[model samples]
Target chain A: MTQTLGITVDNISVTYSNSRLALYNASCYVQPGSITALVGPNGGGKSTLFKSIMGFLEPNQGQVDISGLPIHKAQKKQLVAYVPQADEVDWNFPVSVWDVVMMGRYGYMNLFRIPSSKDRRLVKESLTRVDMMDFKDRQIGELSGGQKKRAFLARALAQEAKIMLLDEPFTGVDVKTEKAIIDLLLQLKDSGHTILISTHDLASISTFCDRVILLNQTILASGKTEAVFTEENLAMTFGGIPTIRNEERGTRNKEEKISTIGFD
Target chain B: MILDWITEPLQYGFMVKALWVSAFVGIVCAVLSCYITLKGWSLMGDAVSHAVVPGVVVAYALGIPFAVGAFLFGFGATVAIGYVKENTRLKEDAVIGVVFTGFFAFGLVLSTKIPSNIDLFHILFGNVLGISQEDIIQTLIAGFITLLVILLRRKDLLLFCFDPNHAKAIGLNTKFMYYTLLLVLALTIVTALQTAGIILVVAMLVTPGATAYLLSDRFERMLAISVGTSLLSSILGVYSSYYLDAPTGACIVVLLTLLFIAAMIFAPKYGLLRRSHSTIESN
Candidate 1:
């Protein structure tokens, strides 16, 4: 089993270059070998938190440590992987699915980035895992939204990182793709991978994720999903009243709540 | 007759030097252009190439090598654009426009004020046929380094251009990659100045990659096609200039534009004609 690494963000504050305080003393701890859903409204510093944890930007206040190591050391050890949002990349870029997936092995390769047989095997295996091997040679722009998401997921999987951060993985994907992604996340959890995902899919959070972090610039509420995913907490996180739906209330009510809550 | 057409240009020493230097510049520009087009930095290329004018003029005034002044100004333009865009609310395109044109105008003003032998017409349009031996040496060395850097860092650069966030997550220093790309862009613009000049160099940096983009769906293939298109156009452009009694730089850019037009209409998958035909077939 892979040794999953926990993420510890210690009261980090991130201010943008324009002097906008995006995240303010926000802190969250994601346990090892668990799935955490980071739920928040737009402009709520979910991205800021992710950036801080990934060391993409230095936190103005505190530190981010992965397991026992600093963020940069964890990164150097390839212990973390990030699947960016669909809008973060230019799909019209001239790389095929195979080429994008092969990038996962670049850190392991030498300066020229020639993929060894092992790297190729890992790429093929990850693509097959995501059921995207059939579209390996196709350009990224030709893929459906779901397939693009899967291709990026396959890239993260190929990285063999113990800690995975997915920024809004469910947005703009079809239901089938969403289901596949959930299943893959579950499997990753079972294999002892620590996963943190920021998403607006509130109902599904209780379904698959073990823990939930409701955030608005700072950590509002965080604990087991059943405990932290309350109506009041949702209201605070989304800055609006949210009607909680029991599992027995059916997906229709849950979906209605998702729409009415305005987190989407 | 065909043999004469091919051999006629080779007989002249200047034409031979022009052919060699232009071809070398074409390869480097084409390679970087793949990244430039895909990264949507076409305007940035235009900005840097134009911004190098003041640098060249200063080099002439101070009796320094043109490459040094050109590189400093090209690099300074990019830095200024970045700084202004970061500090202000203006969009990147606006920043680029403001900075590059200012530098270019400053160069023109300086040229008029300084009593140097620098010809503004030649600097703007290029004088590839009359390139000095020292300029040829500078261009070749600079181009070689730029080509080597692009080749060695191709994968990282591709990732950086495609999805910087993903590149960052994978422990890549995206900032370093960003500056490395800028450095190469500056170097490439400096080298291309000899063959294409300040104004036409952006065409050398853009058209080939764009044409290849329309023709191929793969990055590697895009690169190959860009190189092939650029090299063919360079060789043909030099020969056509010989026959037409035209500027070598203008001929090269015209050829590149023509090839781009041909690809836009005739490329297999993404061509306008192909799409129209497909729609007709479906209808």
Candidate 2:
């Protein structure tokens, strides 16, 4: 099989029915086997961009091409796995963790067919990878925040996709769980899967992501971590509000003074 | 005593046919109700059931089989409600409340307007005591088709109900899934109306499923348990009503309610009363 990897966004723009412009002529290419962090402030179109790329939302202009296939025309959608924000799901729904993870194979399983032994094995392996094999039979409503995130991650892993789009996978998780998840993402990246994550945490961007796309409705900056995390670019992306600047307080102060940007 | 009640009812052909029809309707509604409960569309089922009343009244006035008018008007109401929910800002419950009540009230007014000696109570609360052979055959046909559709689309339907976002991500036509489910629901409601009436159909569709939810964690098991409980309730209620000379629909609803209360108290893990008791014990 041909290796389907890499995604190219060419001048993509999106607007909602309420006449709110989300993305404006945004353009970027996600290289194969790279971990990219899409970082932005609240209401910065990060989720919108993710949704457009996933073909859930149609762009008003330009195009999104995934592995030489237009996103709209992509045949093997099973190649891309998406883990939506936990808050978007209803926890009270009567489903087990295993049941949720098994859903990842729905695309591959025949419409009328039951899960085969191979599918079961894959589900088990995915759960084991997330160290959630013990909780497979547990109800989703009874899980902690971190456990819920892990279970969702297990579902994505069961998809066996080449690209994973995770929306704030580490939000509201404990420090240990956060580190574990980040480490797992790095391992997946090393194993030749492309991972794109959206996060509000700038501190982890430099250490965890190979490239960072600073987004505030559009691509404010896209490059290596060191280049995109500049104090000036950070100030601009965050609307002149300084991010937590414990380590780079002097640098941010100097940049603010030089740039004459007012911070409320 | 049990043999006497069974033999006495068996002697009457209409009574035997009524029991058969109720059994078939009970099985079909119970199986489909699993999906309705899982999807949180119990109220939608209620709305569809009530909306079919106007159509039933119209068909009676036109000297046609009540099922024809009921199916047409029932399906029309379902489509109208679906369109309103998708196109308007009105919440689904509010839309359902308005549509079903409007149609049912219209049905009541139309029933009063007609000079025919048709007993309106028979239509509102099913006359299981007077089921004809034709009714039995019709219920059987509807039950078979509903079961076939459900069996064929079981996996897809399960995935759609549990995680629609993931279903959409996999390129499944989620809009088709939604409409297909509503279509099946309409069919089930129409078929069940012959045995349980509109008011009691909600109990048949919701109570068994809710009880099953409290008992099982797996979809297949939940569906199986719901069908089992519904069949048991239908048989017991029908027999009890035959012996005691009570309303069959009311008896069935009462039986279902008792089963639900029992499940709430005794079922493990998901049961509310059980969970509360366990919490108190642990504390």
Find the candidate with the highest lDDT and give its number. Answer: 1
Candidate number with greatest DockQ: 1
Q: Across residues B1-283, which tens digit of lDDT does each residue of candidate 1 receive?
A: 9999999889999999999889999999999999999888999999999899889989998999999999999999999999999889887889999999999999899889988999899899989999999999889888989999998999888888888877777787888999999999999988899899888999999999999999998888999999999999999999999999999999999999999999999999999999999999999
Q: Write the per-residue lDDT of candidate 1 for residues A1-264, one digit (tens) a residue.
A: 233489888999988877899998787789999999999989999988988899888888999889778887788788999998888778888889998898888878887888999999999999999999999999999999899999999999899999999999999998888999999999999999999999998868888999999889899989999999988788777766445434434566667766655854
Tens-digit lDDT track for model 2 on A1-264? Answer: 244688788899998867799999999988788899998888899999998888888899988877778664452567788899988787867679998998888778876757999899999999999999999998898899999999999999998988889999889889899999999999999999998999977778788898888899899998887887788888889876563543456656676755553552
What lDDT does each candidate get?
Answer: 0.90, 0.83
Number of clashing residue pairs in every model?
0, 0
TM-score of 2: 0.86
Task: Report the C-alpha lDDT of model 2 over B9-29, residue by residue, as the tens digit.
Answer: 788777777777777888898
True contacts kept of each: 0.76, 0.45
The regions of model 1 sitting more than 4 angstroms off are A1-4, A15-21, A58-60, A241-264, B279-283
Q: How many angstroms is residue A249 displaced in model 2 relative to the true structure, after the best TM-score fit? A: 14
